[model samples]
Target chain A: MKDLTTENITENVHAINSQCQNPRTRYIFERLVSHLHDFARETRLSTDEWMTGLDFLTDVGTISTDLRREMILLSDTLGLSALVDSIDHPRTGKSTEGTVLGPFHTHDAKEVENGYAIHKDPDGTPLLVLCTVKDTEGNPLGGVQIDVWEGDSHGNYDVQYPERDGPDGRGILFSEQDGTFWFKAVKPVSYPIPMDGPVFNMLQMLGRHPNRPGHVHFLLRKDSFDPLITALYPRGDPYESSDPVFGVKESLIVDLSEVTDPEMAKKYDVKEGTSLLTYDFVLVSTRETLKLRKEKAEEAIKKMGRSMEDFQGLPILDVD
Target chain B: MKDLTTENITENVHAINSQCQNPRTRYIFERLVSHLHDFARETRLSTDEWMTGLDFLTDVGTISTDLRREMILLSDTLGLSALVDSIDHPRTGKSTEGTVLGPFHTHDAKEVENGYAIHKDPDGTPLLVLCTVKDTEGNPLGGVQIDVWEGDSHGNYDVQYPERDGPDGRGILFSEQDGTFWFKAVKPVSYPIPMDGPVFNMLQMLGRHPNRPGHVHFLLRKDSFDPLITALYPRGDPYESSDPVFGVKESLIVDLSEVTDPEMAKKYDVKEGTSLLTYDFVLVSTRETLKLRKEKAEEAIKKMGRSMEDFQGLPILDVD
Candidate 1:
């Protein structure tokens, strides 16, 4: 009887793992089975508790949609995202640190000219953002595409606003020939995650808070270089010490130092007296094939018995 | 930082277990964390893969309802239900052996008189069900409630029929003072699980079938005794070797010996020369609290931040 039970769990795990067709997926599924079985044995988990866990997971999927990536958010809030990111992008030297992309990034940002303001309802706190892209040796990488987005003072993204459109607080800009990029956007304010879902309820039940510090989203890419997807959090926000997603990285934390020099503001096309914040990004050369990543994703979907058409325009950030 | 990750997972596990409000729950949660962390470290699970698993679980919750019991079905199919039953019951010589309750048993089966046919459609071959409830020392338990349900010749339960109601294929009877119970229900046929949902898809992906052998559901209870929830399957069926739920136990298997005696058939209220199936159920007495086990369901819901109110009327099986 004991042998039978062991064989049963092993067989089920093998069956579930074999469903994956891709190497990465197969790797993951194989790991999941071993862990799941190990868990069963170690915990002597009851049928009722396992079923309850299954029920909980089911809710995670139901709450997810194009706009809400509950599953990804769950992963993020659980530190799985950071763990994966850390493994995939091992920090070697001066390469830009990779952080969570978060769930608010949209693909339809309007291309804005250098020094153009992306914020629609600027709250009169004039600010300028200047970024420079360079290689390990400090040589500027001109014409790099830099996508930028941030939350408003009220800690909500443009997409979260029902009446907004066309990237109200988002922009894409190209670096100048000297590898310098400048854009005008409001200073991002700290925000709390959507606390209405199961994630929120879990936090409440555990006596944890759900606040992420003030941060700006960026996805920078250039020819022959690794695509960098990350976020920059202000150095000094109370919640910075306890980001709900565990997204904060020492290298990515930038000081939004108050700049009062009028000449420095004028150089960035901001009003003479406006404040300014500056940060530089260093990128590494792309060594892996992007096509491989895309194929891995497609293979995962096929293994899941789904088609790309089923997920078209569905929000992918919730799983970020 | 590394220590922090370990601590976070540990604390989360504790939080989940604490929500269970039972020793069994706490035991299971602690075990689950050890296994989960081991799996994470062993496979270096990627963010995407972790998120996908979460997505699969979420779907399980969405598909579950008061009627379907997808989570219970999941547990049954995965063999966790049987493992749990074995642990809780432990085959004490004095108590009746327990099996999975399955998803079809409903509340308040129609009370049928002794020797009445429970099957409405008698087009199939007729079989008589004879059962006796005895204590370990062969003493009978009188006034015991014996609730029974079975599938039709087509291998479908009455509840599976949208137009049927009021226990079309279910019967409730009280044991005689001598601790003997007898009834007549249809000869059940083997059937497959519902071939939709993630569970079905998972089975198909794993190259496994969803067939379960013919069986009859029984819930026997008497005052001051451990209520027995079990199922009895015909001794011979091709799928008996691979019951999808692993619900078949050696003690629960009974032979349906062919009987051609007209006198015997007439005495049992069956048409002349009908077949007979004789089986007995032995129950042990205990005081284990058997209130419905909700498991870690609330933690799951809170973690996903989804409301359960939106999902009503969906069947959620409780396999004991």
Candidate 2:
């Protein structure tokens, strides 16, 4: 009789592997199975532990809704989102590094002009954000689109608040003809992720905190160049290097300086604030395709993290 | 600046690891993060591919309900359930092997005496199952409780059908003083698992069928002995070796011979049945503790896959 040893599990894995019609799917499933079996062995996981893990995942799923996605949050806290980001947006010296697309980026925010008030909440310190989108060689590229979002003064996203279906602390902005854009907003602050669910329970059980560093999430793109996803971390945040999601990168951290230029304050419409945020996005054509360079880019464009049916493509500029 | 390379992901992993309060939780999370990172690197997954994976998991969670758990089934079809089974229920030459506790066991099935009709559908051939529960030393332990369940002749469980709140092709039977029990039912047949959701779509995409070997699930227990969970597979089934869940074992397979004796048929109250299924369950106490396995056996007694407020323990025997 064939026994149920570790070796036989490998044999079964191979048996299932052979049945996969898609080669990439087969590769992924085999690796997943092997790692899972190894994890079980490494932990010598008992029945209760196994059940606990299953229950945890079930609870994560059960709480998922149109407004909240616990699964992605699970992935984030587990450091999976960071790993996938590293793989997809590899450290090529030229392009900006990409980070996770946290489950708060919505598509309802229309494209605002170069200078718009992104954080209109009256409680937090007003800060101005000025960014110049450019190619790697320092050539200014106008009409670049950047989807920006961050929590308000209370450290909760627009969606986190009830009766707030549209973006208040989020916006879509296009660079000017000179490839420079600016906006007014509250300086984003560090915040703990939702800690009321099983994911948080697991973190608490592990003695870990659920805090993410303060940052503004930006999805920047221009046609013919690859998209760059990065969170502009407030420089000197305590959790910058110790983010629970492992999303910190030294290059992505930017410190905002207090700008007192009277003329500049009037230009950006942040009359009430003393300081502003400034960061320029340097874009490049990594020429990297999606899904292991095998899948069509369009295939990925549609599946991106938004319920918005139409992704407004890059605006065509007179000068390429 | 440190780049977002595999090395940096490791750095991020370390950053998160430093905050873990519990050593065991840290170990598990670190290993999980490391393996997940490695998987991403080995696959060089793209953004779109990553999104697809996330969406697949989200869909799995979206469909989960009181009646179905697609996440556990996903684990089963991928052989994770089997690996966990083998880990938690290791290969001991003395006891029966354990398999999955499929999401169908209900506490509604009352404990019946010997020679009960589990399958009351009245459409299929009658099956008379006779079994004896014994310890490793061949000692007949009287008053063994065995919870049995199986799909009906249509290859569906009562729960899978509408409005069937309790078990029909299921029973909780008490053994006679000689440690034997008999039940009448339809000979269970091999059937495909529920395949109308994302789990089935994954199997289909992998070119794998959703068939499980035909078997009767049994959860047997006595007061002092360790519990035994197993499935008695009918011999000669087409999907025996290729069970999609990878749950087949030669020792668990048994063939029921045809018994034409009118006298024996009358004894079990099954008239003119051509086949008789007999399998003696050798349930040795491979003692195991729970997660908080330190709990007395009584704690586990009530929570064995039932939604009951109380677990009716083993029927008191005449002699302890």
Candidate 3:
């Protein structure tokens, strides 16, 4: 029998590499060729089946938008997002536990004081969240900046709302002299991923569900430490067993308990039955070179005319 | 030195396959694992760069729509479409040359008699096309059904028009007892693929053009012979050398000549300067099993709730 698979992949790799302008692109193309070839060899994949996969991908591209980040969803659903995240943020003894940043981090968030309210909607039950920044040694890290965002009670983020302005429910707050930060906002509710795009359609075709657990977003940064961008999910949401993007981590879960202290509530200007979530974030110092490298990578993408909006959305997974 | 690549792929494949229900699903997943692994090996690809590629794919999925087939375009641009077409239509000595069906073919066109007008829009110059169907032995194949569709001057198909019902500029015409079929329609002009989607964005990023040559679609069937689903391009088009979809075939090109005869114009009910395209289609009769197999494969997709409209607005390449 003829070994056509090797020939096909070699030719494909050559063609792709020839068309690429940069070393990175050439590297990616070459890998793509090898992998595609290996897939063909492993499955003895028929030509027609391969065509169908191509068709599926084309539909994926067509359904993508500024609000619906189907490509990111695809990666997340495929578990590639978590894999890449883990590999990029390899554990270095005491480094913070890394997680997927997700596709909803919109820039241009309002800069506010330490205890400002990020939510403008007055629908959900109020919650007070007190966060503190600390080094691995448990020393306070003052003057650190923390960016936060989360969905509303209905599980819809501010960006999902039409009338919202510039990163709804999103803000940048600096830690106070004691390295503590507090914010008043509504408790996030579990929401379904956007099911109107091809990702949803594909999930349905594959017999999967579209639900993600309740979670709050955070991006923390301080001098001499690696910036951490992650999400904290509710401790026991039903969907915690299967986050569509596989973003869940044991250490990232925060407990939200109801506090009935009238005096404490009055001091924080909250009602008696308000919910409170308290958690302290731990960071690890890293070489400035790594930070500079990340900044340069981001700068290159921006200079290439791509925006954060171009990369936001839910993952496509079998929600079974 | 740790070789995480093989171990990671094996673990993922094992997990995914354990969860898969069918052989086909398991096969596809296993292939995906191997391909991803091969890609990593070929380039020693970085996690961040891989994440960027994932981001690109996510955008592709987000932009897909019911009418615009971006995933199909991505496949075509990547040459996967051509590869699948080649494998599915492997030269079996007597089979019709198969090409990419593309993302623009509409389902269930109106059945019209020979010589009927298929074009609803009168903006472009009129063209009368004369076609004949014949067997490999040069004998006419009477009563053969020919389904036809073509893009307009702007490279937009009738299905792309919001106001159109069912398939526009798309219909089925049967050959008469003389094995001749004729249709009245405007001449298709080569146009650029939709630049609004990620496929176009990718092309721009890669410094590639998104042009395809003018072509007409057809799907011919007869009880005694093989059914043919294919497209024919104009003999000479500027972008024929770099057809975006790579669907063009030398034998499929037809000559569109200017006709000046008044009687000929009167017969076709067109003006003096109207162009006339004449082409004879020769089909080869293969084994009955092959024909049935192809039909069964096509039916499987149809059973999966796929319609021709699912493939609208796709780029059709010029055959050199």
In Å, residue A254's CA in model 1 sits off its true spot by: 1.9
Q: lDDT (0-100) at residue B175 of candidate 3?
A: 91
Query: Could you estimate the TM-score for every candidate?
Result: 0.76, 0.87, 0.69
Runs in model 2 deviating more than 4 A are A1-3, A288-320, B1-4, B11-15, B18-23, B287-320
- Per-residue accuracy of model 1 over B1-320 as CA lDDT, tens digit each: 21234225446435533544334444454555555655554444455556566667767767766556676777676666665665444445445568887777778577777776777877657778777888766887788888888888988887777787567778888988887777777788899887777888766755567888898888888887767888888887888767777787677788887557877776776776566777667776553322212223333333434323211211121212
Can you write out model 1's per-residue Cα lDDT over A56-124, one digit (the tens) per residue? 666676777666677777767656666555543444457677787777777888888888888876573
The digit string of per-residue lDDT tens for model 2 on A1-320 reads: 13455447866766766777655566567667777776665545556667677777878877777678778788877667877776566445666778888877777887887677887699988777888888878888899888988898888987777788567988898888898988777888888888677778877776677888888889988888778888888788877766777777788888788777778767666574466677778776645433233332233323332121211221111111
- Output the number of the DockQ-best candidate: 2
In angstroms, how far off is A62's CA in candidate 1? 2.6
**lDDT score at residue B256, model 3, on the 0-100 scale:** 83
Give the CAPRI class of candidate 2. acceptable
Task: Report fnat for all candidates as fractions from 0 to 1.
Answer: 0.29, 0.51, 0.30
DockQ of 2: 0.29
Chain B of model 3: TM-score?
0.78
DockQ of each: 0.21, 0.29, 0.20
B-chain TM-score for every candidate = 0.81, 0.83, 0.78
